[model samples]
Target: MDRTTDIIIIKSIDQLPSVDEIKSISRERALKLVFKENINRQREEIGQYLDDTLSGFLVLIHKIDPELNIVKLITDKEIEDHQNFFEQCAKDYRQLGQKLVFMLVDKLDLNLNKDFPLDTFNELKRDERQIGKVAEWKYFVHGFHCGFQNIITGQYIEVPLVFGLEFGDLDPYFFVKFILSSPDYHPLPIPLFEEYADGLRIIEKMVSLGKFEKIHSKIGGHDGTVVTDREKVEIKSNLDLEKIFVNHIKEIEKKSKFNLWKFLGLKK
Candidate 1:
């Protein structure tokens, strides 16, 4: 239960840790990347997969738990699959976002006052807690404006990323809002939409047949101490987790495009 996940940047492969390898994302800071300079254009680049070879020394350490390293309970294949999803969304070298990849679900009320605490919601806006190691579930990636001019993604937590070279240009305002060319708020052309729909249909069947795996990780207590309790939680850290969205929350679907009214719920 004392497992931990950390990012270690090294100038050379010699710095690789002896512990079981989780996964790593490294790219040369000098590598040229073409992305929109603003939010509007970035939207147009959706459904693009990352196939770039990084040149610099960088790493991304996700939430994992082993008895010793605090690795997740999922298998290695699942871990690699999750990392692929991250790399695809985190296509740009810049890291400056907060988001959630939530599962889709059937009708069920949020069970909260629809007045929807404007003030609370506003406060929630400043929150920075990320749901960790939550792939393997049927979900969509909820991206925020990540990759900032300042502040490295995992700097505060001291992600061990070594840079033997200088940094390079990155997508200025990259947004992680692509769905395999699926029409977002703006609908795609019929041909493109059809392609996306067909791909999604296959994925739906695969998931229904349990093609994907599920992972589990332990949540820490308020004081940063690991805890086993899974309910009635409150964390007063910078995360500002005053009230969780709803314990074991799921998005219950109802609208054409995914929205709050339609969101996910745990399958009974």
Candidate 2:
């Protein structure tokens, strides 16, 4: 499945291997190790609140493009635009007599040219009679493999969004997206791809600065207990996740004034 959440590493900088040293290792092997270590660490430390996909694709992005400063990409104008979008979503949902939230999650951008087996699969294509057999063979080999491209923007842009309707259960595993082509929706006020990228930088800053605990604490006081279809699941939404998220952003704005570069010490 296309994951709708970014893998935010909550561990301290000292706990992770140096980027220079990490780059020396095979990318696949390095990612595997990061998954192993991060999963174990998160389970042992703060598994109660912060659930994350344990991978280092973001690290690879940094290594691949050394000057790819995601932090530098976030701007005040962008944040305002993002917050406005969130408010709009909230307003629309309320009019529909439902609650909605958008969450920024870690997304894996795979180079289909390299990572996907398109050529290999094409080579395995068969005649009509053997279609079932070939499909079975492909399934046996590739399983659920698919390309990682955004259907809307047609870009390699991969980002995850978390959505759990007000009355529904929220799991780390669930997400929902509304397509513009769908009859139920209107055109978005802002460009989604640009907004997502900016929001990612903000989330990146929050996670990197070791504010994971603080952020969760801020929202923890509110009740998270809710009954789902099967049983009760505690999703850390302070009644309304959209409101909590907006409040958190407001707090962040007050704290850093949205100048993440200065707050992160990337600026002099």
Candidate 3:
């Protein structure tokens, strides 16, 4: 009944909070936030998987280059076909760019007074007041864009993800959009099916932590009274995680002949 979700806006990489900061709402609200965060975390893993998959494919294609003597007699049509296929795959990634991973957890053991009222949860809708709060929360929570600059197959594909939540008093449902930039932006909705079931598993861990081991805190309410014994929502305040992508790019350079600057033709 009370506003339990903490509103913390993370502006810099240095300010990232630990997983322990999650202490806000209880029951469904807390669970929802956990689900969202799990999805956010998985986006990075999915991006890396895609990068590795694409890179491995490119290595095979590179073998056909004229610089390699093994393919001295390859046909032009064959080369074109490979190029076309790679381009098409990139296009497909662009289309799938906006997809969001949604997953439901089995919480028969939660023992909460009110369950989410669904056996398998795909989406949840709240009223305007709640939706506005959630939108503002997600806007600040999912505002940043971070991922490796994908240059495999001679294509520039960056997974710059953006998240948005919206609801209108007159509308029948709440809307969430996960936007990904494949050099071209695509906006997609969170679906009922799990894009990755691992997200659900992560939330299960969070839920167990939240239910039994939460670090309780106090906050001042509008009446200037301290609200005690409140569950704190995890505050993730740092943008430094984005540096993982930079590190990944460096690793890619170390392992392969992919000279980024040379690829850009700025350096020999």
Candidate 4:
């Protein structure tokens, strides 16, 4: 499943912990302090109120300025003492993410719910067999897979039957072109991509002076066959994902103008 939300509180230089604090303490501590200081208390309940996919989940503060700090929630005695503090940290960040999503929605000028980039399942119309097999996958993409469950049920249709192309034949070039297709043929609105890019620019400004690590996805790319082990790459936009997908979607608008004609059965 292509899912995951990376929530961040972009802190200014002065707003961030002092150099001494960052140097002296663990990342978890620094992040908690950042939350304690910066998060707006009024937005604390936004997570429950929204009650979407991103809610009830902890989006760890993956990175700060000078270094990468992917704070993990440990389940030991040491963590138990600070559990309340850490819970609030997660809540604050979740609310912060919820607020930013709404702000992005407002910027898009779309009447979308609080879940701006709603992660919808394989929601198809009409007949069930019309869709083929439905696969639901939940796995890690940040560093490595720690736990996972990927299941596919129902009549699975061969790729050639659906897209008139072999699954193995699908490559980056083709996928990129397809995703980058004209807005007229695209499933998602092109404006959403534009607004996402705009929001990233704003985040870039917010953490200009602080340690801003390029968003990196734990997931790697496939070159038709093998799933290669990968390093953390610069994935801007919240997830290495948003930045990457946003860039890909935006590029589709720029380079694939002929898609509209093709979709209309016109020679392109």
Candidate whose TM-score is highest: 2
lDDT of 4 by residue, 127-231 (tens): 332222212422211111011122432111111111101111122222223223323233532211222232233223322422122222233431121011122
lDDT of 1 by residue, 1-268 (tens): 1222343333332542432332242111111122223432332222121111221121222123111111222223332454433233222222211112011101111132212222222332344422222222222112211111212222111110111010111121122123221122123221111222233332333334343221221123211111111112222222332243432243323223645434555443
lDDT of 2: 0.29
lDDT of each: 0.23, 0.29, 0.24, 0.29
Native RMSD of candidate 4 (Å) = 21.1
Determine the C-alpha RMSD for candidate 1 after optimal superposition of all C-alphas: 23.5
Per-residue lDDT of 235 in model 4 = 22
Off by over 4 Å in 2: 1-74, 93-188, 194-197, 200-268
Better of 3 and 4 by TM-score: 4
Q: Against the hidden reference, what TM-scores do the models get?
A: 0.16, 0.22, 0.16, 0.20
lDDT of 2 by residue, 197-239 (tens): 4344433433343321111211324221111112222234435
**TM-score computed on alpha carbons, candidate 4:** 0.20
| Model 4: residues with Cα > 4 Å off, grouped in runs | 1-75, 111-268
